[model samples]
Target: MSTKLNRIDLNLLVYLDALLRERNVTQAAHQLNLSQPAMSNGLRRLRDLFDDPLLVRTSDGMTPTERALELEPQVREVLMNIEQAVQPRSAFAPEQAQRVFRIMASDYAESTLLPAVLGKLRVQAPGLTLDIMTPSDVSFLDVERGKVDMVINRFDSMPQSFHQIHLWNDSFSCLLSPENPVLADFTLENYLQAKHIWVSKTGMGVGVGVDPDDVQRLGWVDSALARLGKKR
Candidate 1:
C-alpha cells in the first residue's frame, strides 16, 4: 500500500481527478468549490506526496508528467468506487424531489430537445421548479461553477469535468427561395458566391458568420496518424 494513499484524505482524489482534467488551477478549484489558493495548497500537498511535478506548464496548457499519467486511471477508479460505496441505490422519484434544476442551452436546443424533457418533468415532477437560461459564451463555465445544474449545447466547448450524453445528431440542409437570382441547379461555386443574411447567437442579423455546428461538421478530417493506426 502507498503511504501517500493512506495518509492523504481519500476524498481529495475527487479534486485530483478534476484538477487533471481541467489542467488549470483556477478552473479545477472552481469545479471543486474551493478557492484558487486553497486548491493550490491541496495541489502542493499532492505534489510533495507524489514526489513529481504532476502538471508541467507549457505554452498551450499543462501537460501531465509520466508519473501523473500512470496514477490517473487509479485515481479515477478509486474516486468512482468511493462515490458508489456511499451513494444510495434508490431510484430518483421525481415527484418526491422538490429540487429546482437550472439548465443553460442554446435557443435551438431549447426549441428542439427541452420541450420533451420539460414535458416528462411536468408529468413526473410537478413539485420541481425549472429555470432555463439562454446560452452564452461562458455556459460551460457556469456548469463548472455549479451555477447551473445542467446544460445542452455544442459539444466542442464542453469541458471534460462534466459527463455528457449524446442526445442526437441533426443534419443541415441548404434552403433557397424560388425567386432567388441563382439557378435552380446551384453548383458549389454559385452557392459560395451567394450572399445571405447571417443569424447571430444574440438573435441579431449579421454580414455572415459560420455557426459552430457547421464548423464542426465541415472540419472533421481525422489525423493522418490516427488513420494509419486504424489501418494497422
Candidate 2:
C-alpha cells in the first residue's frame, strides 16, 4: 500500500530521516538545502502530525525516544522503496555528484572526529565538499536552525523532533607541569596545594547560557577542590 496518501508530505519523511540521522535540525537543513527556520517549521509539523516529541536533547547530545526508534526501520524501508522506484541506482558516484555537507562541533570534537571522517571522505567522496563550524555559546539550536550542521557534545536533555547519533563518549582528567617540585610524588595533598590555572567562562550560569557539561565539569572541579581544602 502506498503511504503517500492521507495529506501526508513525503518530503517530511525525508526531513525526518535526516533529522534522525543528524540529530539536529540545522544539520538536516544543510542536508536538505533548506533554512534553519524552515527546518524548524518542518519539525513543528512533524511533531504535531505524529503527536510525538521524536527527539530530545541530553547533556551529551540528542537522543531518540522509544516512539522514534520504533518508527525508524519502517520509515527507512518506505524511503528506500521510493528511492529505488525513482532512481534504480545503487552506487553513490561522488565524482559526478555535487554533494556538500556542513558539520558543527566543539573544538574537542573536531580534534577527535574530523580527522577520521575527513580521511574517509577523501577516499570515498573526493568530489564532495565539507564545511565545518566549531560551535560557540553551545547553542545546538543553531544546528537545528540550519545555521550550523551536526553538533557534537556530551549527551543531555533535548526536545523531541530532532535526531541524534552517539558517536562516542568522553571523560575529564587533570594535568600538571613536569617541573613542579610537588612532582616528588603524585599525592592528594600535592594536588590540593598546587596552583591551578582555572579556565571558565564567567558570564553564564549552570544551564542557561553555558553548556551543561562545562557547568557540570566546573562544579565537579569545585567540589573536588573543596574535599582537599583548595580554593579556585
Indicate which candidate wins on lDDT. 2
**49-128, model 1: which lDDT tens digit per residue?**
78888888999898889898778767865776788899999998888998788888878788998788889988889888
Best by TM-score: 1
Model 1 weakest lDDT span, ten residues long: 216-225
lDDT of 2 at 209: 67
Cα TM-score of candidate 1:
0.56
- Compute each candidate's TM-score over C-alphas: 0.56, 0.47
C-alpha lDDT of candidate 1 relative to the true structure: 0.71
